[model samples]
Target: MAQNAHGGSRPGVQPVALAAAGILLLVGVLGFVPGITTDYAAMRFAGRHSEAMLLGLFQVSVLLNILHLSSGLVGLALARRIAGARAFLAVGGALYLGLWLYGFFIHRGSVANFIPVNDADTWLHLAIGFGMLACGLLISGQVGTGGRLDTPIDRP
Candidate 1:
């Protein structure tokens, strides 16, 4: 299937990167909504004190939502190119994995939970982390037999 702005003859990261970015944007926006995010009023700039939970599942805060929004925007921008997309995924994935590891040390109600990550957020971060990293690592091989594996390339 021919996809992406440059057409289908290239190993594009549109599907995975775009999808991931879109989800992040959606989650970020939803987190701000009152009903969607339970206890929306409790969301704080940064701290475990924020009781806001996105979709009544993952705990969220102003800081968390902002982070999501920012990351999603960056992902969208980077997805325009294979190199950028791969970098976005790889770097972002590593950061998320780091966040996951940090979650282990930050207790549920500890003051150190500045990001206010809970069990749900923690696990989800782990999933996104590995998923992004895997996508980045494997995206290069997505181009079929005739596709150009390099960026800034135009097949004649």
Candidate 2:
């Protein structure tokens, strides 16, 4: 397979990043919906003051949803280039790691939980952190494998 716009195979971070971006974008938009985000009226601009929760599970706020939306946009923009894809993954990993840290230290019901993260969101952040890092690291090496490893038929 020829290199795509990102100078890598079509199965690289381009697809995964795009998917992630889309999902995050949808989640961000949905967070603003009344029923989807319970107690929408109480949604604070920032801080743990917001009682709104996305899907009535994960804590959320206006600032948090907007941040998610912006991150998704960035991810979409970077999905077309190998370098940009790698950068996006790396940055995403760092952001998730930061979120993990924030989740660990912030008071769940206090103003510290500006992101409105909860246990579920914390774990999800951890997963995103590791997954993004792995994607960037693992894919960097496979970009030019030349299909040699998969050519069993040519191993006469």
Candidate 3:
């Protein structure tokens, strides 16, 4: 496997992906906590009316937290392989971007707002989409051009 300019032996993307997953999981869990998520009782499954916020900044709900956690896990799991990581980032980014679009179109107070995203969340999702995709695509692997895979072609 190729080594970075540094002496590390593993690909850089895996660590970042795993870290993102961990952070997402933490955020999801925290959103459920009363103190952490202020106005716990007012939290709803979805919609703009939900008074709960993650870090008192981003709007959140039970469904939204679950989705965030799940997406993070998927990103970490997919990071085990280069191709999988790439696909996860690309697809995940697209999904988030789509979610941002959905947030824009959906009426915040309507029943259709399942994710409970607000204006802040819509912007955040857009950032996540671009960031995740960029990280996956830009991170160099531990091995040669083909990534960390140990194949005959990569063993120069």
Candidate 4:
């Protein structure tokens, strides 16, 4: 098995976690940028009143950006271990799925829509949930007992 810089024998899960973390970090940072996030001045700390759109697509606020940044940081920290990476993916996926449902069911202008999620954000959340869940489950097979990398089974 190939060893990663962290000395982990399983390289698959770590890379996935790292990539996801990097993307989250980038999106979070872009939300604060003027051009990247349109109507930057209109961004609120939280709630439906925020008019800021990240990449002119998904709605965002200071709270949402902070969530993304924190999630990214957590992902980066968890990527050091296979179990931690798997947990991050699984738990993160579930959280996104829950958020998607909340956005889908909640009225857009209602106070319950505290995240102020739009249609695009809801759909993106759905995709991210499935993608993360799939990655976590698929990669888990490569993890052996005691959290070590499992050798591929030989075929006749």
**Candidate that would win on lDDT:** 4
Q: Against the hidden true structure, what lDDT does model 4 obtain? A: 0.85
Name the better of 1 and 2 by lDDT.
Answer: 1
**Per-residue alpha-carbon lDDT of model 2 for 50-102, expressed as tens digits?**
88888988788888899889988998999878678778877887887888888
Worst lDDT run of 10 residues, candidate 2, spans 141-150
Query: Candidate 3 residues 1-156, lDDT tens each?
Result: 346557655546666666666776787888899888988898998766788987788889888988988988888788777677777777787888899899889898888887788888899888888877787777665444554545698777
How many backbone clashes does every candidate have?
0, 1, 1, 0
**In terms of TM-score, which candidate is stronger, 2 or 4?**
4
Q: How many backbone clashes does candidate 3 have?
A: 1
In order, candidate lDDTs are 0.83, 0.78, 0.78, 0.85
Off by over 4 Å in 1: 2-11, 141-145, 148-156
In model 2, which regions exceed 4 Å deviation?
A: 1-10, 141-156
* Tens-digit per-residue lDDT, 1-156, candidate 1: 345455644435556788889988998899899999998888898998898989899989898999999999999999887688888888989988998998877777778899989888999999999999888887764453345456655545
Residue by residue across 1-156, what tens digits does model 4's lDDT show?
455448777647778988888888888899999999999999999999999999999999999899889888999999888888888888988888888899899999999888789999999989988787778777753544344445577433
Error of 1 at 139 (Å): 1.7
Q: Which ten residues in a row have the lowest lDDT in candidate 1?
A: 140-149
- Model 2, TM vs. native: 0.79
Regions of model 3 farther than 4 Å from truth: 1-11, 142-156
TM-score of each: 0.84, 0.79, 0.78, 0.84
